[model samples]
Target chain A: MSAPSSSSLSIRDLHASIGDKPILKGLTLDIPKGEVHAIMGKNGAGKSTLAKIMAGHPDYTVTSGDVLLDGESILGIEPDVRARLGLFLAFQYPMEIPGVTIANFIRAALQARLPEGEELEATDYYAKLYSKMDALSVPRNFTSRSVNEGFSGGEKKRCEILQMAMLEPSYAVLDETDSGLDIDALKIVSAGVNALRGPNIGMLVITHYQRLLDYIVPDKVHVMSEGRIIHSGDKDLALKLEAEGYDWVEKEYSAGKSAV
Target chain B: MTTETKPDIDIDRSVGDFRYEMDYAFDAGIGLNEATIDYISDVKGDPDWVREFRKEGYRKFLEKPMPTHWATKDLENIVFENIRYYLSQGQVPKRTWDEVPDDIKKTFERLGIPEQERKFLAGVEAQFDSEAAYSNIKAAVGEQGVIFVGSTEGLKEHPEIFKKWFGKVIPSGDNKFSALNSAVFSGGSFIYVPPGVKVKHPLQAYFRINAQNFGQFERTLIIADEGAELTYMEGCTAPKFETATLHSAVVELVAMKGAKIQYITVQNWSSNVFNLVTKRGIAHEDAEVKWIDCNIGSRLTMKYPGVVMKGKGARGEVVSIALAGDGQHQDTGAKMIHAADNTTSNIISKSISLGSGRSTYRGMVHVPKHLKGCKNNTECDALLINSHSRTDTYPAISVRGQGNAVQHEASVSQISAEQIFYMQQRGLSEAAAMSLAVNGFVNDLVQQFPMEYSVELKRLIDLEMEGSVG
Candidate 1:
């Protein structure tokens, strides 16, 4: 187990399954620091599976894999350990945690990253939370509502971004964040994600459509087919896929596979 | 009050490391017999009618079979011959803490009764074993014509009011335990608020059991006159003992026209105790009665605090939370009887069963055919924390009137693995996650508690949930 050349998020030859069915077969990807990359694929292309496995979801069994965060293996660690080690996943559909307020949910996440016995400063926490909520256009009273309970799709997405901002993770994987958003919501969410792009963090934005890439433009775009990345190119590759559709990529990638 | 001191008390004879056999001025000995009833009546110096009442109650206790159908069969283990009907500190209640007996005062101190009274309560009563050792009401509240004292004093001094309401709401023959309590009922709080006089703070009573195989039967009666408002809270805890203890109490409340009464109880008995308590209230025209109860730690607890709407436009509510830990059974719920027109009642019960524990919700709501515009709602939710934990719901709701409406909802849920993993991903350990989930399951009902008590309840629940799951 050697480190990847770049000190960023990297998944090496990952093979994962849910029960007896394999989802990700030898999936390999890398996103170096200071850059955002996108994985555009059709449904069942192992897009959400990649994000869940990266976050150490309990349902999935990773038979052979090495997930490295800053050049250290995170293969056998628990989900919380991986989370505290700075891995964040913005769920395609956020969980509705009844009776847990939004403020407490985010507070617990941040509190978990703190040293044991260290109390969270209420004033500082509220201050940071209010600022982030304002940036994301979430109402102040949203703090009292149960997490995602009775929330509209847009509000739920914005809440996911609000958490990512508050946690300030080293790497984040936004899984289909644009699925349930309209044009206005998409732009607002894109802007929030764009505001979080910086030099020290790496991000992998997974989406089925290239429309999301129009706003949160990635430095590089990869086309995934059948649980593995088939081709990698610059940002224009997303536009090419969006215009020509996935049929051309599937045909061309299968041809190349057969030729090999 | 008669002041008699017994010289035969031997405080050094320890029955076991955790159990004690304190020599009582009068210990009606173990058993329910004519002699025991006569002994108790003689000790209390009851009037002729009261003595006759006790004799009748003793007969009823023998006649009324154990509610083997509704109550758990464990009731058979409560040997009537093995339980001392009454064991007191053998001292009348004093008005001040300084005047209280040292041994009893130490117990109250350990339970934080004095500090809580000094901080937030309008009055405080401490009952040790079978008698009230200390009772006091704040001067300000007393000046406003509030009455807070032990039941004995209330009956002896204010018989005009006590005689009318006592045993009226819940008759002795209503249930087996109520009859048992009626026979040996000793020390409990008796509170009265005059018309149009509202107490600013809650009146609290703390009950502690010290002797093993000793039965603590406290009879409480609370009355709120017309246009009055008051809240009463009770807390109970007993030391751990190998021998089983019996705690059967009967509490009755009466709210006059347009009055309001809120009763709260947090019972944390030792696992060796069987707590079978009967509590009910009567709400008159436009009156309101609420019961907020939390049951945590008893080997078996069967309590269903009820409310009967006896007058039109009255309202009744019961918000209860029960937690059953290892080797515990909590069969508790609420009963609402809509006997009048245009009455409303609500019941919400939340229970948690952990580590092979069992929790059952047995509720009943009834509106007769003659009543009109009566509405009742009941919701019972149970959370099972372990694979082996058990929960059951038996809700009986009947609405016979054409204009009446009744709704009952019950649900049993287990902690979700996905939710636990989600919380774990947010940095909480599995145990911490489980604790948080359990707290959330009961958070809505707990929020109905007073802020201080709710905080304390959360802490207690957290301690119970530790190591509940691996």
Candidate 2:
């Protein structure tokens, strides 16, 4: 349990829905330790839905699926339980929690991870938080400010990465982490994420464009359409997809479905 | 995504755990009339003129009609004939802690008043059902010519200072409850600070209601002389009762030229108590007055602390936080009256409605045409924890002067699902997440309170949030 094993995050036939309409139809993917996987899909391709379902979001019903963390299914547990079991999802649009300082928020998260009756040391917590914030270029005074309130796009992303650094989740799901960032912010955020890469962690980076793949250079590239992965290749395939476009993948998937 | 969805859960309605046997030395029989008023005045050994004042107040109380506009349905249930006007354990307020009676001393100890007084407070006054049990001021503070005593002693000992400003700020016939409190007011704080004296520590008073179906009316008057500064804090708590209990207090503060006065109240009445209080301050030239109020655990509370800037360059502020649990209504706000030039006022109010509770923010800010350079800013925000919980904001702002600037901003928002989900994703339980968000909502204003009070306020809110809404 101390180290992220091979295939730390494995998704087998994940079918989820929002209300009556199905979103993810038999979606499947996996990421092992010491590896980064990128999933590129167009709008309505259920990319964000997959990330949310894995985090046990209440709005999205997992009709039929098996999402495993180290070979144990986490389909029926609550969202907080999933988080405590070493799962983290970086939302595309982080929520604005008014009046809750960043320092208190992170402290509560870390405190929840501890065993019962074990108090979190305030001095050590602040020291670790300050060092991590320094690495992410966050200001020293941000610890007093409310969580994600009046924050810029880059600051929010960096704050997300800062949380990841603090929580030390076994698997990280970065859902469209590069949605609203400028190039400079993207680079800073990517470097922060790169610094967290190690054999103890697995990452699933879901995005709409191949541009984010250029900086964080995933070990595997996935192309998804209509709620399921239709193609998988090495990192060079991302460059190839950028050279071409998503139109070829949709056409090829339709043709393959007709043949089936 | 716009409206936050609250989980449906019934609130816990258990009353407070602190209770004592009904052991009253004397009890004025149930009802309000001339006989009752006369009996109270006779028992307290009131002078002739003050007895006449009580008769006048009773007439006004009879003439005034119930305030039907502000939560009339809850007001209808209060049966005046069934409520006992006064009750006392007959223990006179003593200067020494050891002289106070056993049960009353034990109650204060349970509330941690003596411990707090030793740690931080400059003076303390403990009031039982109808009279002060113990009132003492530190020797160092008393040596600085600080007059702190019960209103009875204030009127009896220092007639020159007490008679001049006693009923001037809040007249006996101001409101129905105020008139009632004036007619039968028993025990409250009376303080007079000499000129140029600044009391570093806060003076506190604790009021506890022990008997059932009793109404506690305390009159508090604080006067800060020219260039003087003072801070006063009062806390109220009551034991649970089957019948309704009424707590109506009248507090008047007068800040003279260049003086400053800060008044803070933390009220946690039982769920069966009706808390209707009238608190107002008058600020003279270049003076400042601030009111920090927090209300929790009451059935119906209708209180609006107000300030009147009557002289040039005066400033006033009101920071309030109200928590309405199940079967409760917290209708609280502030009123600012700018009567002179260069007067300023600021109000920040935050309220939370949990379970079937309802909260309302009713504020009024007025600047006359003759005034110039008057400024006011008001921010009222409400958070609803359950779908059944409700909130309303009525801001009546009138700006007639050309140079006056008045800003009023209000928002009614529930705890969003996204925010809770985000917090839960960080490994916080649903209850913990809700409480954190709520404490954060009032954190800014809570910080303005004294350190001891701020911590206690947070803890009180945390306890109130437990089993409030799922």
Candidate 3:
């Protein structure tokens, strides 16, 4: 197989399935460094499957695929190892870890990235954490609360963003991060994500609505259906799909498939 | 205290788990019989009544059958005749670390017991195998009219207090294991706080089982007089042996009127030992008795530390954490018996099972009719590392009184795939994620332990979680 761009997260013809039920069928996409791309698809369109597959969720088996992280294949690695290699997945539905404080949970994650025998600098970590939390408008007391336990939907999303800010990953996949947030929360969360946007990192914003695009606008957009990216366009494509709905794209995809 | 001259025990000092070889000056070799009891009594020069008391205990042990109808059938594996009930290097306990034997001192040093004693303990009693090697109390605490010494020394020196409450709380006929411990009871802590005397620092006891095919029966008795308060902590560990090692201890506590006694135990037996202990305390009027226990690394452990509220307005609590690794079963819980009006009790137990390990929580709360205004709250939470791990909860609450409330809440949870995956996505390995989840399951209960113990407990849990996940 020819190597893709070394500075991008290249997913080439990724085919995966849960048990015998196929999910991602020859899905191919790329988000190079210094840019953000959005994937728009309805429910059960394999958008979430793609995100979970990249993180190596045990339930999904990759029939054939190549996921390159900066010229290195991370296809069969452990999820944590892949994460340490700079691939982060912000879950659509975050888990509630009872009794684990958000501060300690994130601290452990950061510590895992450090070299053996190296200790995290407490004072520096706290300073950075406090600043990021302040930006997200998360209360200072949330640092001591159990991670996502008894938290509102917005709080969970903000915590996911907080972890991303602390990690500063090379590549990030925001899986439906905009789903469970009201307009007020969406603005704060979008601002948090936008603050993290820069030339050093690549991001894939996966969502079903164009509303999120109005806030954290993506440089490029793609329409995913039936486990594959059927159509690709610029940011205006999202607005067109929002105005005309996926029926137009669905018809076009069927016509393209029938023609082949 | 007589010091016997013998060859030094030779073993690798760096490997704390290696058992040192030594010849016991007093060894009531293999078996439980009348002769063994007589030999032990003769060795200790026990008075007539105490000697007869042990004989009666041995007879009772033979009469009571093991409680296996509802428990695991593994109880049949313990060979009474093959166990060495008594083995000791020296009969007399040393008053100073310098006078303690080199082998025993090295063991305690490796465990960091002496350093902990110096830093935070008011007194420390280090028991090795069948006898206390060293027992000492801080001068200031001693001046405050507190008695801290080995059980043997306490029985001989302060029999008026020790003999009165020795087996009053948990008698020989309480259970099969308790009967065995009573018949062959040896070195354990005996503490007494005088009226109105408050112990500033905790008194600690460290027990080590260093011999194979041995049954360590250490009996402990603690009493807090009226208006007195004290905290006692106990920790135990044993070397890995091919054969099963038995550790059965009977501990009785007495909290007099308005007195408070807090007992903390961190039991870290090797996977080759069976740890069965009976611990109970009596709380008098306006008294409080709290038990904080942590169980780790035992082949099989059955311990239920209980409190009997005998006086009005007495408060009882039991906070416990048990971790069962491979080939381990931790059957532990709490029992609260409210015998008087306006008594209250609370039980919080958390357990983690890994690698096909099993943990059982069996609780008993009894508030009979005619007892007014009694209350109890029980919360049990179990965390499983994978599908193979197992946990069970059996809570029997019998409340037939007016104005009484008893509540029990139990939950069995596995570290969900999504939970682990979420943590893994944040960069933790599967094992670290599982370990964190397990730690979180018991984080609230850990706060009930001492600062030093909670830190050590977290480290121990982390070590146990290694290689638990694929």
Which one is best on lDDT? 3
Stretches of candidate 1 above 4 Å error? A247-260, B1-26
lDDT score of residue B285 within candidate 3: 100
| Model 3 stretches with alpha carbons more than 4 Å out | A1-3, A254-260, B1-16
Residue B233 Cα positional deviation in candidate 3, in Å, after optimal superposition? 0.9
Off by over 4 Å in 2: A1-7, A251-260, B1-16
Give TM per candidate.
0.92, 0.95, 0.96
* lDDT score, candidate 2, position A31: 86
- The worst-scoring run of ten residues by lDDT in candidate 3 chain A lies at A1-10
Residue lDDT tens for model 2, B300-387 = 8999999999999999999999998877889899989998999999999999998778888989898999899999999999999877
* Per-prediction DockQ: 0.50, 0.84, 0.84
Best TM-score among the predictions, by candidate number: 3
TM-score: the better of candidates 2 and 3: 3
For candidate 2, write residues A101-181 as lDDT tens digits. Answer: 999999999999999999999999999999999998899989898999999988898899999999999899999999999
Clash pairs for candidate 2: none
The lDDT per prediction is 0.87, 0.89, 0.90
Give the distance in Å from residue A117's predicted Cα in candidate 2 to where it truly belongs.
3.0
Comparing candidate 2 with candidate 3, which one achieves the higher lDDT?
3
The candidate with the higher TM-score, 1 or 2, is 2
lDDT per residue (tens digit) for residues B231-255 in model 1: 9999888888878899999999999
